[model samples]
Target: MKKPKTTNRYCKFCKKRTSQKLAAVKTGTPSSLKRGSKYRMRKRGLNRGFGNKGKTSRGALGSWKRYGVKGSKKISLKYTCGDCKKVGLSANTIRSKKLQFE
Candidate 1:
Protein backbone atom coordinates (compact mmCIF):
# COMPACT_ATOMS: atom_id res chain seq x y z
CA MET A 1 0.00 0.00 0.00
CA LYS A 2 1.04 3.58 -0.66
CA LYS A 3 2.14 5.64 2.32
CA PRO A 4 0.02 8.55 3.54
CA LYS A 5 1.29 12.03 2.80
CA THR A 6 2.94 13.33 5.95
CA THR A 7 4.66 16.69 6.08
CA ASN A 8 7.05 18.15 8.64
CA ARG A 9 5.61 21.62 8.44
CA TYR A 10 6.53 24.48 10.73
CA CYS A 11 4.24 25.46 13.57
CA LYS A 12 4.33 29.17 14.43
CA PHE A 13 3.69 28.34 18.07
CA CYS A 14 6.50 25.79 18.14
CA LYS A 15 8.66 28.07 15.95
CA LYS A 16 9.95 24.94 14.24
CA ARG A 17 8.88 21.80 12.35
CA THR A 18 11.05 19.36 14.28
CA SER A 19 8.64 19.17 17.20
CA GLN A 20 5.55 18.70 15.04
CA LYS A 21 4.10 15.20 15.35
CA LEU A 22 1.89 13.36 12.89
CA ALA A 23 -1.65 13.84 14.10
CA ALA A 24 -4.06 11.12 13.13
CA VAL A 25 -7.59 12.04 12.16
CA LYS A 26 -10.15 10.88 14.71
CA THR A 27 -13.02 9.33 12.75
CA GLY A 28 -15.56 7.91 15.16
CA THR A 29 -16.35 6.53 18.60
CA PRO A 30 -14.72 3.35 19.80
CA SER A 31 -16.52 0.02 19.40
CA SER A 32 -16.42 -0.66 23.14
CA LEU A 33 -18.59 2.41 23.76
CA LYS A 34 -21.04 1.64 20.96
CA ARG A 35 -23.18 -0.66 23.10
CA GLY A 36 -23.97 1.62 25.97
CA SER A 37 -25.77 0.18 29.01
CA LYS A 38 -29.55 0.20 28.94
CA TYR A 39 -29.66 2.12 32.20
CA ARG A 40 -27.50 4.83 30.71
CA MET A 41 -29.50 5.19 27.53
CA ARG A 42 -32.27 7.72 27.66
CA LYS A 43 -35.44 7.78 25.61
CA ARG A 44 -35.74 10.34 22.79
CA GLY A 45 -38.80 12.58 22.67
CA LEU A 46 -40.17 16.08 23.35
CA ASN A 47 -40.78 15.25 27.02
CA ARG A 48 -38.12 12.87 28.23
CA GLY A 49 -37.81 14.81 31.53
CA PHE A 50 -34.12 15.55 31.77
CA GLY A 51 -33.80 19.29 32.19
CA ASN A 52 -35.70 21.24 29.57
CA LYS A 53 -37.88 19.64 26.91
CA GLY A 54 -36.25 17.50 24.23
CA LYS A 55 -36.97 20.30 21.77
CA THR A 56 -33.45 21.53 22.45
CA SER A 57 -31.92 18.14 21.69
CA ARG A 58 -29.15 18.31 19.07
CA GLY A 59 -30.73 15.69 16.82
CA ALA A 60 -34.20 17.25 16.91
CA LEU A 61 -33.68 20.02 14.34
CA GLY A 62 -32.49 20.11 10.78
CA SER A 63 -29.15 21.70 9.85
CA TRP A 64 -30.84 24.92 8.70
CA LYS A 65 -32.92 25.06 11.86
CA ARG A 66 -29.85 24.46 14.02
CA TYR A 67 -27.74 27.17 12.32
CA GLY A 68 -24.78 27.95 14.60
CA VAL A 69 -24.92 24.58 16.34
CA LYS A 70 -24.17 22.78 13.10
CA GLY A 71 -20.65 22.32 11.76
CA SER A 72 -19.15 23.46 15.06
CA LYS A 73 -16.81 20.54 15.77
CA LYS A 74 -13.35 22.06 16.17
CA ILE A 75 -9.99 20.42 16.78
CA SER A 76 -7.47 22.20 19.00
CA LEU A 77 -3.94 22.48 17.63
CA LYS A 78 -1.43 24.06 19.99
CA TYR A 79 1.72 26.00 19.09
CA THR A 80 4.72 26.47 21.36
CA CYS A 81 6.27 29.66 19.92
CA GLY A 82 3.25 31.85 20.69
CA ASP A 83 2.28 29.56 23.57
CA CYS A 84 -1.23 29.47 22.16
CA LYS A 85 -3.71 26.99 20.77
CA LYS A 86 -5.54 27.42 17.47
CA VAL A 87 -8.87 25.85 16.49
CA GLY A 88 -9.38 23.77 13.37
CA LEU A 89 -11.80 26.16 11.68
CA SER A 90 -9.45 29.14 11.77
CA ALA A 91 -6.54 27.04 10.59
CA ASN A 92 -8.53 25.46 7.74
CA THR A 93 -10.04 28.76 6.63
CA ILE A 94 -6.67 30.47 6.60
CA ARG A 95 -5.11 27.64 4.63
CA SER A 96 -7.96 27.56 2.09
CA LYS A 97 -7.74 31.33 1.54
CA LYS A 98 -3.98 30.99 0.92
CA LEU A 99 -3.28 33.69 3.49
CA GLN A 100 0.34 34.17 4.50
CA PHE A 101 1.17 32.32 7.71
CA GLU A 102 3.03 34.13 10.45
Candidate 2:
Protein backbone atom coordinates (compact mmCIF):
# COMPACT_ATOMS: atom_id res chain seq x y z
CA MET A 1 0.00 0.00 0.00
CA LYS A 2 1.15 3.52 -0.78
CA LYS A 3 0.57 6.64 1.23
CA PRO A 4 -1.48 9.44 -0.27
CA LYS A 5 0.33 12.66 -1.02
CA THR A 6 -1.29 16.01 -0.28
CA THR A 7 0.09 19.43 -0.92
CA ASN A 8 0.09 22.36 1.48
CA ARG A 9 0.49 25.38 -0.76
CA TYR A 10 -0.19 29.09 -0.98
CA CYS A 11 -3.75 30.24 -1.58
CA LYS A 12 -4.12 33.63 -3.23
CA PHE A 13 -7.69 34.21 -2.09
CA CYS A 14 -7.05 33.08 1.46
CA LYS A 15 -3.80 35.03 1.46
CA LYS A 16 -2.05 32.16 3.29
CA ARG A 17 -0.90 28.57 2.96
CA THR A 18 -3.59 25.91 2.98
CA SER A 19 -4.04 22.18 2.58
CA GLN A 20 -5.17 21.09 -0.89
CA LYS A 21 -7.31 18.05 -1.47
CA LEU A 22 -6.15 15.85 -4.33
CA ALA A 23 -8.58 14.27 -6.78
CA ALA A 24 -8.33 12.31 -9.99
CA VAL A 25 -9.25 14.16 -13.16
CA LYS A 26 -10.39 12.63 -16.42
CA THR A 27 -8.94 14.22 -19.52
CA GLY A 28 -11.71 13.80 -22.06
CA THR A 29 -15.09 12.31 -22.87
CA PRO A 30 -15.45 8.52 -22.74
CA SER A 31 -14.67 6.45 -25.84
CA SER A 32 -18.28 5.33 -26.21
CA LEU A 33 -19.35 9.00 -26.20
CA LYS A 34 -16.87 10.10 -28.94
CA ARG A 35 -19.52 8.78 -31.33
CA GLY A 36 -23.16 9.55 -30.86
CA SER A 37 -25.44 7.02 -29.17
CA LYS A 38 -25.53 4.39 -31.93
CA TYR A 39 -27.92 2.01 -30.23
CA ARG A 40 -30.39 4.62 -29.05
CA MET A 41 -31.23 5.97 -32.49
CA ARG A 42 -32.34 3.87 -35.46
CA LYS A 43 -30.01 4.84 -38.28
CA ARG A 44 -30.79 4.37 -41.95
CA GLY A 45 -27.27 4.74 -43.42
CA LEU A 46 -24.28 2.39 -43.44
CA ASN A 47 -21.86 2.48 -40.51
CA ARG A 48 -18.42 0.78 -40.90
CA GLY A 49 -19.29 -1.12 -44.13
CA PHE A 50 -22.48 -2.62 -42.64
CA GLY A 51 -25.89 -1.32 -41.63
CA ASN A 52 -26.04 0.11 -38.12
CA LYS A 53 -29.06 -1.93 -37.10
CA GLY A 54 -27.36 -5.33 -36.96
CA LYS A 55 -25.84 -6.31 -33.60
CA THR A 56 -22.35 -7.57 -34.40
CA SER A 57 -18.77 -7.15 -33.38
CA ARG A 58 -17.11 -4.95 -36.03
CA GLY A 59 -13.60 -6.40 -35.33
CA ALA A 60 -12.39 -2.82 -35.09
CA LEU A 61 -10.32 -3.68 -32.04
CA GLY A 62 -8.11 -6.11 -34.00
CA SER A 63 -7.25 -3.65 -36.73
CA TRP A 64 -6.84 -0.87 -34.23
CA LYS A 65 -4.08 -2.82 -32.44
CA ARG A 66 -2.02 -3.00 -35.65
CA TYR A 67 -0.46 0.32 -34.67
CA GLY A 68 0.65 -1.20 -31.36
CA VAL A 69 -0.22 -0.30 -27.81
CA LYS A 70 -0.20 3.36 -26.88
CA GLY A 71 1.65 4.70 -23.88
CA SER A 72 -0.08 4.54 -20.53
CA LYS A 73 -0.81 7.98 -19.16
CA LYS A 74 -0.40 8.71 -15.46
CA ILE A 75 -3.49 9.74 -13.56
CA SER A 76 -3.62 13.46 -12.78
CA LEU A 77 -5.44 15.01 -9.87
CA LYS A 78 -6.97 18.44 -9.31
CA TYR A 79 -5.86 20.07 -6.10
CA THR A 80 -8.45 22.28 -4.48
CA CYS A 81 -7.29 24.69 -1.79
CA GLY A 82 -9.02 24.15 1.55
CA ASP A 83 -9.15 27.75 2.72
CA CYS A 84 -10.17 29.62 -0.45
CA LYS A 85 -11.98 26.65 -2.14
CA LYS A 86 -9.99 27.35 -5.26
CA VAL A 87 -9.03 24.53 -7.69
CA GLY A 88 -5.52 24.14 -9.00
CA LEU A 89 -3.51 21.56 -10.96
CA SER A 90 0.18 20.79 -10.82
CA ALA A 91 2.39 22.86 -13.09
CA ASN A 92 4.25 19.63 -13.82
CA THR A 93 2.48 16.37 -14.66
CA ILE A 94 2.16 14.18 -11.56
CA ARG A 95 0.67 10.69 -11.48
CA SER A 96 -0.94 8.96 -8.55
CA LYS A 97 -2.88 5.75 -7.94
CA LYS A 98 -5.45 7.25 -5.60
CA LEU A 99 -6.09 10.28 -3.42
CA GLN A 100 -7.30 9.96 0.13
CA PHE A 101 -9.04 13.11 1.32
CA GLU A 102 -9.33 14.10 4.95
| Best candidate, TM-score | 2
> Tens-digit lDDT track for model 2 on 18-40?
89777767767333523334332
TM-score of each: 0.25, 0.49
Per-residue lDDT of candidate 1, residues 1-102 (tens digit): 122233345665556554332232334543342233221233233246555343334443433355365343443333322223431122541112121222
Clashing pairs in 2: none
Q: Flag regions of model 1 displaced more than 4 Å.
A: 1-6, 24-60, 63-90, 93-102
lDDT of 2 at 76: 61
Lowest-sum lDDT 10-residue window in model 2: 33-42
lDDT of each: 0.35, 0.57
